[model samples]
Every structure is written in C-alpha cells, then in structure tokens.
Target: MIRAAKCSFCGGDVEPGTGIMFVKRDGTVLHFCSSKCRRSMLELKRKPVKVKWARKTREQAEAKVRRR
Candidate 1:
C-alpha cells in the first residue's frame, strides 16, 4: 500500500519532493511529508491507548453460580 504524501493526522496534502521515512520493527516503512506530522505521530505511538470492554468487565458483568 502506497501512502500518499499527506499528513496522517490532518490528512492534508504533503508537499511534493519533500518527505522522510523510517524503518519500523516489523520491517515496514513509514513515509512522512513533514517533520511536524511525523513528530506528532511518534508522540501518539509512545502512549498506550486504553481499550474499553475488550471482553467482560465489572461495570457490565454479572456473577453466576453453578452446582452439580
């Protein structure tokens, strides 16, 4: 998949003839049109996003008992 030269955050068109890249751990390549956008994305990646309700949680869970 070829990512266009656009800001991944803002989706703004990236200036042609001006871009940078880096190799990820998975051997995937990243293309950034500008330093600012790249920095923003890097910062975002550093933080762990919280996922709600991956399965069942106490907030929306119930207790059940079983007997033989």
Candidate 2:
C-alpha cells in the first residue's frame, strides 16, 4: 500500500498518487498537498503559521503533543 505524505508547509496529508513531490539538491524530500502549499514554501517563502488558510498553527501542534 502507498503511504500518505505530510505536507512540509501546512502539515496536511498528501494522499498516495496525489500531490507534488520536490527533492532538493541536498536530497531532502518535500511534499505539498496543493499548489498553494508549494508556492508558500518555495515561491512566496511564507510560513504555514502565518498563512490562515493552512489552519495548522503552533498551538495546534502543542495541543497534539499534549494529547499524545
């Protein structure tokens, strides 16, 4: 079975057979669920926390850790 990837920018899931995969010169693999994520991380160089559309903020990450 194909595994789902987490978006490097928005922390969203990138389902198998969908989304974009980027490989940097240093061999770092980056996955994006949509063009918005790709552009935000690459072109616009924006942070996910600063983008409201992402909705995955630092607080959410802290909450997840607490829940776990």
Candidate 3:
C-alpha cells in the first residue's frame, strides 16, 4: 500500500500524483496540497503556525501553556 504524503505547509493529506513536490537546494523535499499552500510557503514566506487553515497552527496552540 502506498502512503499519502502530507502537505509540508498545511499538514493536509496529499494523494499520490495530485499535489506538487519541491526539492530545495539543501535536498529537503516539500509537498503541497494546492497552489495556495505552495505560494504561501515559497512565495509569501508565511509560517505554517500562523496560517489558520494549517493543522500545525492548532497543534502549536495546544502545545502552549495557559498561565492565569
């Protein structure tokens, strides 16, 4: 069984042959589920933790401690 790759920018599921893949100069591979994610990460330089639709944003928020 082939495993689906998750989008590097949004943490969304990317089915095989359906998304874009980028190889950086450092040899790190980045996968994106759509043009929005690709542009946000590569062109706009937006952080995943700051994107509302990104799963990492929620995860990062949950990881923080709430001090009263």
Candidate 4:
C-alpha cells in the first residue's frame, strides 16, 4: 500500500497523482493539493501562518499556549 503525501502548504492529504509536485534547487520537495495552494505559496508569497483556511494554520493556533 502506498501512503498519500500531505500538502506542503495546507497539511491536507494529497492523493497520489492528484496534486502538483515541485522541487526546489536546494533539493526540497513540495506537494500542493490545488493550484490555489501552489499559487499562494509560489506566486503570492503568502505564509501558511497567515492563511486562515490552511490546516497547518489551525493546528499551529491550537498548539499555541494561552498565557494570561
């Protein structure tokens, strides 16, 4: 069984052969679930921390400590 890769931008599951793959000159591999994610990361230069819809953003928010 093959394991599906997660989107590098949104942290969503990326089924095999259904998403875009990108490789940087530094040998880093990136996978995106859709053109929106790819464009946001590559073209718009948006950070996942600032994207409200990204699962990664939500996870990071949930993981943060609430100091009073």
User: lDDT scores for all predictions?
Assistant: 0.49, 0.89, 0.90, 0.93
Clashing pairs in 3: none
Highest TM-score: which candidate?
A: 4
Error of 2 at 50 (Å): 1.0
lDDT of 3 by residue, 1-68 (tens): 76799999988899987999999999999999999999999999999987898988887777774431
lDDT of 2: 0.89
Better of 1 and 2 by TM-score: 2
Q: Give the CA lDDT, 0 to 100, for residue 13 in model 1.
A: 62
Expressed as tens digits, the lDDT of each residue in 1-66 for candidate 4 is 776999999999999879999999999999999999999999999999999999999988887844
**lDDT tens digits by residue: candidate 1, 1-68:** 55356444334565656677766899976666666556756755521122232112222333332221
Worst 10 residues of 1 by lDDT: 47-56
Ordered list by TM-score, greatest first: 4, 3, 2, 1
TM-score of each: 0.42, 0.80, 0.81, 0.86
How many residue pairs clash per model?
A: 0, 0, 0, 0
Q: So what's the TM-score on candidate 1?
A: 0.42
The global Cα lDDT (0 to 1) of model 3 is 0.90
Name the 10 consecutive residues with the lowest summed lDDT in model 3.
59-68
